[model samples]
Target chain A: MKITPKDVAHVALLSRLEIPEDQVEKVTGQLNAILEYAEMLNKVNTDGVEPTAHVIPLSNVMREDEVEVSLARELALANAPEQDNGYFKVPKIVEG
Target chain B: MDYSVVIGLEVHAELKTKSKIFCGCSTQFGSDQNTNVCPVCLGLPGVLPVVNKRVVEFAIRAGLALNCEILPFSKFDRKNYYYPDLPKNYQTSQYDLPICVNGYLDIEVNGETKRIGITRIHMEEDAGKLVHSGNITNSNYALVDYNRTGVPLIEIVSEPDIRSAEEAKAYLEALKSILEYIDVSDCKMQEGSLRCDANVSLRENEQAPFGTRTELKNLNSFRAVQKGLEYEIVRQAEVLDEGGKIIQETRSWDETKGITLSLRNKEQAHDYRYFPEPDLVPLQVSAEWVEEIRQSLPELPNARKQRLMEAYGLSSYDAGVITASQAMANYFDVVVGHGADAKAAANWLMGEVSKVLNASNISITEFAVTPENLASMLELMQKGTISSKIAKTVFEEMVASGKDPATIVKEKGLQQISNEGEIVAIVEAVLAANPQSVADFKAGKDRALGFLVGQIMKQTKGRANPELVNKLLKERIN
Candidate 1:
């Protein structure tokens, strides 16, 4: 398929991205070109083959149920845009 | 149109792991905020997440308990959603290929067994808790506590097979019991270890297609789950009957108000663009490992209830009550192990023990009376060493002072007045002191004889053997 301007806007909204008003058409064209480039795989045929989920062949990368030290309160809250009483403050979410 | 209620539940239970799912942070609840956060769980840049082995093991165990088929190869997918409680922009969960699938759990309703189909059981991480600054509706901002972040959770999704709210509650009770038996998760609703979101709808009889479903949330207890489902079923039915359509959305159960309020409309929908997590490797659980986990499983609640009923000749309802909790079942078994009669043990556990537990708001595990002490107390009553009335008094003393039953009986002089000579003397004193009752008994007045017996018992401070008192009084009167 072909990409539409509305589809690009919806995708942008879902991703929380803001495309400039005039750049919508150009950006949609660029993204559709990339999609077309990626869609070339549709031409390949591999019947009776399993879909691959991981690129690496390794499996079961896990750690034991052990406790490691957590970051101190100060460092854990270091990058918070807003902090109050050792908590990360966010915009009002009344319906939590 | 006549409608039948259809319900499906998605439950999330936190695993009882010592550490968080992806980091070394503690998974302890109610801890100081932000204390259990690490660079990995905090979603800091340049950090990677390692899956927890115990989490997968627990998911498999829960699957086996639910009689699900385990998938040898499974992987995680990122559920993309932006929320304040979730520090990461996405949640790592199993989407298409969950670890366990096609499971079924049997629930008993009105002495009939109803099987609920399990669609899948997948592993995920718990989101952090959001604490509103003021009243939730009036609050201007919310604070995030990362203490619960990254806690391992297993989401068990059930097929829409439940027909009523009672069945839904039974399913949850059975599920919670199995989780407790397998020792997978804490499964406490109050502490937020176990949470449920229900999908409910109403269709006209079984011939029609399933109706549009609404997801119900914030059901904090089993009662809430049942009551909320009940209310939603009626609400949906009323809406459909009024020639209106049931709008699909998420509704929060106002537990105090006893009604479900719509929180979000379906017009603004969520499309979680799921993709395989590239950081974590695919998990391959061997068949041998699954078999090992199955072997390690304890006797589940249903089978244990069956055995308890068969072996002890207990009623089905009695067995259900006794086996309600693992601790209570263990206590009963221990009491039987100490040579106490099974039926007698069941009676006391269901009656007196439950009374104390409910009154004190404590579990059987924290009860001061030991199984051995209770068994010995029962033995004392059985052997006529103490009257049943006196034994209750001694039981209170045991709970208060933590003393042995025999010691309390001996110290309080609460033993049964079973000696023939001693009771005979009291009987004679009662008879002589009340000639009027003697004359009345000779005149065929049974009330007079009962009064004399009562006087004898009161004279002995209620320690007199009731049977002996009756026999002795009848012998004298006749």
Candidate 2:
């Protein structure tokens, strides 16, 4: 399917990207070309093969219910843009 | 035109585990802010998540309790989203292949059983909470507490088979009880251990298919679930009656306002873009393990109710009430363990214990009186050390002061006055003072006999031995 500029913008918004209006067209073309190239692979016939989720053939990776020491409070908030009373602060979360 | 309400509930219950699902952070609630955070739960770069073994076991037990078919293999997927409370931009959840599928629960409505089909039960991680800085309408931002991040949650999705709000409420109740029976989740709605989101729609008749549906959120309690669904059903019916097209949207239940407000339209729906998580490997549950978990399953609510009825000779209603909560059921068994009669144990649990717990607004788990104390208090009544009336006083003292029944009876001087001479003197005094009731008793009025008996008991402050008072009064009157 051919991708549209509006679809690209919607995806960008969902991804929290602030793309400028002038770059929308250029980015849309690049994305659509990538999509077109990927769509070509869909033509190959592989109906009998099972879809794979991971590259390695591993399964059931689990751990026992043991707790380890956590990061120090200072280090945890080192990269955060803002912090208050040992918490992550963010803009209003409007969505339900 | 008459419309039938069709509802499907999505219940999210936080599993009871010592640590978070994907991290080693403590899963305890109401902790200091951010104290439970670790690199894995905080979504720091280059950190990998390992599945908690208990989470998987709890999910399987839940599936078995709900009578679901556990898939031999299941995988976790990343549900991409943008929310402040989610430390990670994407949540690890089950996508196309959930852990359990095609389960059904039977709920009772008007003494008739209605089966609600469960589409799937999947495992996922919960997000943290955001305490808004100001009024919601004008808040600049919010503070995020990551304590709940990575907490294991199982989302049980139900089919849209519910015909009314009452049925929806019943389905939720049954689901909560089953989870509580297995001791997987605390199922405390206030603490957000058990939460529900409902999808509701209306149709003109059974012949007509389900109309456009709207999803509702922010239902924190069972009352909210029922009331929210009720409001949505009526709101949809009114729109249909007015010839307005029903729009697919997500609505927020304004509990204070008692109306649902449109949160987002269909166009604004997020494309969650779910795909299998590459970091975590797929889960392959073997038949042996599933069988082992099944064998270890505790007796569920319905079975326990049936057993109570058979073992205690209690009516179905009484058994059902006593076993509604797991803690209460365990308490009932403990009370019986003290050698109290099973029927009496059930009665105390259903009547006096239930009433006190409700009035105190505390759960049976937090009750001050132990089963031994309660059983001993019942035994006090049995041994005639205290009349049932005075036993109530001792019961209150035991509950309030956490004292022993016998000690409370002794300290308060509330023992039954069974000594024949003392009761005879009290009865004679009552008969002399109430000459009217004495004459009425002589005239063969049984009601007056009861009145005179009541007067004697009142004179003894409800501590009089009732049988002795009756005998002494009868002999004197003759």
Q: Candidate 2 at B476: error in angstroms?
A: 6.1
Candidate 1: docking tier = medium
lDDT of 1 at B260: 96
lDDT of 2: 0.88
DockQ of candidate 1 is 0.72
C-alpha DockQ of every model:
0.72, 0.65
| Position B316, candidate 1: lDDT | 91
**Which prediction has the highest DockQ against the true structure?**
1
| TM-score of model 2 vs. true structure | 0.92
**lDDT (tens digit, per residue) of candidate 1 on B321-346:** 78878889999999999999899899
Using lDDT as the measure, the top candidate is: 1
State the lDDT of candidate 2 residue by residue for B225-299, as single tens digits.
989888888888889889998898998898899999888775555688999898899899999999999999999
lDDT of each: 0.91, 0.88
